[model samples]
Target: MAAWPWKSLARSRQPTDGGDSAAPGKLSLSLSELFVVGTWFGVATGLLELGGTLAAVKLMGRVTYDTLRTNWHYFWMTPLSNLVLFSVSALVLCVATARIPRLRTGRVVFFLYAYLTAWSLVSAIPTLHKTAEVVLAIGLACVTTKFLTKRRSTFLRIAPRAAILGAGLILAIAGVDVYSTNRPVDRGPSVASVAAVGPPNVVLIVLDTVRADSLTPYGAERDTTPNLARLAREGVLFKHARSTAPWTLPSHASLFTGRWPFELSADVGRPLDSAFPTLAEQLADRGYATGGFVANTQNCNAWYGLDRGFDHYEDFYENATVTPIEVLRSSRLGRYVVTSKLAQAVIKRAAAPVDFRYRKTAGMINRDALAWLSDKGDQPFFMFLNYFDVHDPYQPPKEAERRFTKAGGEAQSAANLARDAYDDCLVYLDSQIGRLLAELESRGKLQNTLVIVTSDHGEGFGEHGLAGHGVSLYRSELHIPLMLVHPTRTPAGTVVSEPVSLRDVAPTILDLLDLGTAPTFAGKSLANTWSASAADRDFSEPVLSEVDRADHVPAEVEDAPARRGRMRSITANGRTYILNGDGREELYDLHDDPEESNDLADLADAQEHLHQLRELMEQVTGVQENGE
Candidate 1:
């Protein structure tokens, strides 16, 4: 039987199959032992992974079990899932390796450096503990394969039944322990809050890839969001509203639950747990008719459960080429596997690319949304409408594209010039909003309706090393525009600059209608802001922003010893932390370098500020003593 890998790290009492002492006076293990260790490590890690993830479902939903088990699903993550997985794998490997006596003592120094590097990465993308565990397993396998001699490497050799039985017993105990951790309970009265409105109609519109500074009301260079501008001029606008996480899933999750991405699964790739009560869920329980109309394929994934609380969720790009996963799946393989593995493979390839590419212009999504809207019959509804026309593949209508290219933007890329098309789409969406408003008015429901318009974090336009969104947490990603067009009784033409978080939106809405629920929500209400003047507002520090990019593991080659690992970021205390894939930290003062063009790690004062911000960040992200 092959001895465990750790047994080979140094000499042990066990003899090698070769019957020869592998090394001199120092004890040594045969190569076969190493392979066994790797295999054992991999199997245990995979099981741990399954167990840990199950726990995540509970953690995210803040639930033990279901009352009826009607709709129990999976975990949902935002953008940095790959990064989270990588970090978590390291932590898992760390614990597993500690069991190896020879390997444990000999690689103390090496393990310390490795673990610190791993911890730094794991902390950034907090949800990927499973991914990290897997990576560690793979790491062991890789090392074992590289060192083991071909002599005993053949698969034909098998461990004796007794030894195999022992290993299996250990594994079974480990799995059971993990399973024991999950004690399913009944939160019969699952929720404690309800919005106190006569079921006032709630309309949440998320404009995908909309840049923060692009709208005229926000002092943009162009009149891109004229319709939104009109609404801002007459409604309440949150001047410093920031998204909790980048990308669609995480940001949207925050928007719905008023929580940060890390608090949930954090692996935007996985399915979200349904136990948590989102805003829509709350409203639905309150007897409001709920529905969702989404244009982005990213928002319509099964894992996200954006359709969790809605009764009628519409997928508009059905026959269109706009469905992101389907398009990618088709590109990788063929249409035959459009809704399967091919789609998933394509998504990773397209998203995690060397550079980036642009596809269509915006308006198509808006048209679909409008089509869906034309059929609505008001029943005090809670409807979510997300439009991705402003997102990349910036192909605008030819006329709009021509208008911009001919007027001034001819020098831009196909995607950029398509901005006109995007602008046109945004305009169309606004017009559609206006139409909806008119419809409500015609039905005498306009005055009582509560309209909230926001972008799910803004897009990046060639700012840092990226374009569009999903790269960093700068003003571009977190600083989105939010407007509340409530009943006139709530006030109007108000702009709140009070450092409001997307996490606070749910509480704010509940509070607005005098909903008798505890205001335990993370976001503060802008309802009162509608009655206050801009100068009277106190927004201490811009809204907090974070971009944990730990998962982008660069493809590496063995011969080339310079492949960097991954980077994770924390932006607070006026300094932006740039953690590189190579396990290096870079600090930049945003006040000094708005574009983040310089690293200020050596600045003593800057480091002091960084220290403070880090403190606040940990609290905001909720690192409780209870291990939440």
Candidate 2:
């Protein structure tokens, strides 16, 4: 019926005279020439795929150019990684062909090159139909193979030059990226001079995704945070501190600006707007050296506007120092291959020794912060540290894990194992905190520093049928641990039982430092709560927490009430009123049901309280229930 595709190559491979020229309609290549051509072809394919993926991601508006530039290493790393992968593949094919006389026809090599290139290009186009992608890839491969056969000499002649140019371009880009990202920080001249004896150096440490109930200070059975317990004993601990939101970005934004989450422009895929001045910005304006050391690069990076006022900001790089596997993950082809379960397992095992941790651990963050601290001159400083080890995908160090979990704990149910791993992470994080505090004390900075420790938001582990933050506005996610340690201002063993929102953090910090509040700050300062006598304490402001509609809904909760719209809760007078998105309301008495197991929304006696809460929410937020 039909002749095999490689028959044409077989006819063309007949013995050639001892020169580069081949007979008309016939092709011949020495082993060296075959390898060079194949390698160049592979390199070209890689360049095409790289360009296509970048263009597609850009066109979809998923990330900004500034983000790519700030993280520029990935830009050059991906192409170089692709080049190595494709070149090795070509070399292997050439060697196999040389070993087998029957494979010398070159049709198999040409088809593979065309197919691989076609597949890469197709994959780069996001949301394309799977069936169409396969059909297009195969059709393109056939056409490419035919063209390569007909113009074999032209392709062979041009490949080496192209490969050299491509290689040079990648190197040039790499040089530029490295230089730009590593430029020295811009520490502008002090705008305002400080007094000889100014306020204590402010060190705000945020334990990300840590629930109040998980720590010993909040009555946890286990001593997951002995250092925090010590701090609570020596500092002013807010017993009912609540986050303004249940997620990282908004909660952090509120913490910095002393404003509600909806009042700011921080949301999914949107960076915090620079409308309101941040605590660091205000502190820097008053001549404080500000530095931010964060382990959660995904949400806490400079690209997200969290680094607006910091003179020095350290974040985790995608590939701190290049390793082959990290480079592979940066490429389009490697990403596709790793989608297969078997490939993922193999790659995970291979990459364990090199890049096992998803983000920088608490110890690494401490190391960088300590280094920065040691380098500071005599300026009063504002140091913000974010520890992210307790966030998710909990994988604690072996030593720390052993303290909380057994060796064969993976055999437990997924939820139980996750909780165990979470506790293990907390143990590791607490140890790091203890180490940091000890180091600071040794350096003579602890006594003079105002150490304010808290969490951005709490985590959810089967609480209210939720397993993560950002999906619900329950106590498990909103309640956070807040404590401030100062040698003179805060007395040891002081605890405030009044409910407070994280929105008050910035104002309180400014208030404590004797700096005037910005005009745009919404929350009242809590300085009086800790500093004033018990009879003068005023923490009457209602605490409000809001969670916007989720950008993505997990399949398990597709039909849940949380998928309806935004949710808001108001906590006051030891009572909580939840206004759910689907027009449902829930009320809980904190004194009777701390776990919120019982709801009093439908109780006739609670109707007046619900009405009062709704009125309070409307008055505070200036929005009615009907969205008027």
Candidate 3:
């Protein structure tokens, strides 16, 4: 008997030509068969990967020229990498199957081809990696049967011809695609007329779910964000900055368009209307190269219309196309064969804890940002970066988590541990920010860059019966840290206490660049307020923050009625007026009740202000009291 069951199984098979089959324990791939199988495997893998990547791009609605140009390497490199990996796999499988007495049969080759096709299809769908492995196992089982062993010679003769034809067709299509993508077309005078005057590059970094109070610069007792504090010293800080909405979608909409959320059709799941010009569109029209690097996979993705006018939009979550080897290595049964014992031991001892702790942390984000920055030419560029590090599921790196809380401590409650993790995430984010700044400085881009640091909204730490954002219009959820660092225009150590809304960000950036704001913009430019005398400052307008709870509800909530429970909060003159959609109102003197502990709604002096603010909300959103 042979040393292995497969070798014995090979010897058990009868020779088709009545000649002696291969002797026991002597099964290996001949040079000629190896050449044919290896070439066929390479060509088939390349073709499948290219075809699948193009299909995935179409499915993702990212087939535009700009997207293809920016992500060209990803499309080609991923497939070529898979081709190399699958070639090695094919060689091993070929050698093993050659040991069979029916080695001259082509069923094994066809099975390898089928398996490669399955891998290409499933690898594009990040959720179906395990499914591909299952398909391959079933294919192998069928290929090893007696039925397929009988039809070997005829199958072998036909497969090579079919593979060559398929390869040629695929290569031709791929070549045409490459040519079309690289071919330039007329962009018209609008693109040509928008010449650059060496304006400062703009970098808007949104720290998702980061509250103003959590940062050291914002009076947090803990040193949660030392880098941000240093950044504040290098520019100006708006102490009373507020987001237009208490969530990612509408807040980002307002920030990009300089329009109030209600001014446009801004809501979750609904793409922003093309009629509303985004900051990127405006900058792109003005000869500025625009790029977006967003880590918030849920809200600020391409399907949500945040990719408008970005020459290069690289969302980390959009990296769904991986190699088949990755799929096999991740599979349950394949893990026993694919991974080495030393690798398994190291992963168990070293990688497991770190993997459990951090999930695509800010370090990866900074690396991508730096790479893009290196590619961004001297043209004035507008880069929109959204970091999800400070968002929920706050699993900071083990080192960071250990700095704040113990692994198995008494404070293991979800809320307490989450808060500790949140702080650690902030520290980790600060380090990333520091690294980004260093990279920019090293490249001499920092001096010419206008860095705007802010957040979509703040997280709720069980305040007002809320643990996250987007559900309420409370102070903790509306308040955000807004800081600006400009080389020549913004003076260092400048603090602006006047109330400001994030909707003003777009107009302020355009205003600084001398690019006129659009007539449709609801938010006025705050350029004068950036560094103006007390007399020149305009502090009359109340900063409005709103939350449309009905539109923002989670999809899992079944049988949820159309609550129409939209709430709007307006702050002016140290007072906040909240008009809950059901004709109820609350007033708080933010000066004395910063935590919003005291409700002064019934007071006669506060009623007039509350009524005025309610009228403003009604005028803005076109929603009256009594729940719509």
How much does each candidate deviate from the true structure in C-alpha RMSD?
Answer: 15.5, 6.2, 9.3
Tens digit of per-residue lDDT, candidate 3, span 364-443:
67766666665455678888889988888786655554457666766577778888888988998998898888877766
lDDT of 1 by residue, 592-625 (tens): 7755667676677767765565455456555421
Candidate 3 regions with alpha-carbon error over 4 angstroms: 1-197, 318-321, 325-359, 398-401, 549-564, 622-628
Which candidate, 1 or 3, has the higher lDDT? Answer: 3
Worst 10 residues of 2 by lDDT: 63-72
**lDDT digits (tens) for residues 264-379 of candidate 2:** 87776567778999999999999988999988877776656778789988864543555556566666666565455787788678665334345778888888787677656457
Please rank every candidate by lDDT, starting with the best.
2, 3, 1
lDDT of 1: 0.51
Model 2 bad stretches (over 4 Å): 1-72, 89-163, 172-199, 317-319, 338-359, 404-421, 532-542, 549-553, 556-561, 626-628
Judging by TM-score, tell me the better candidate of 2 and 3: 2
Q: For this target, which candidate reaches the highest lDDT against the unseen true structure? A: 2
Residues forming the 10-long window of minimal summed lDDT in candidate 3: 63-72
Q: What is the lDDT of residue 119 in candidate 2?
A: 78
- Return whichever of 1 and 2 wins on lDDT: 2
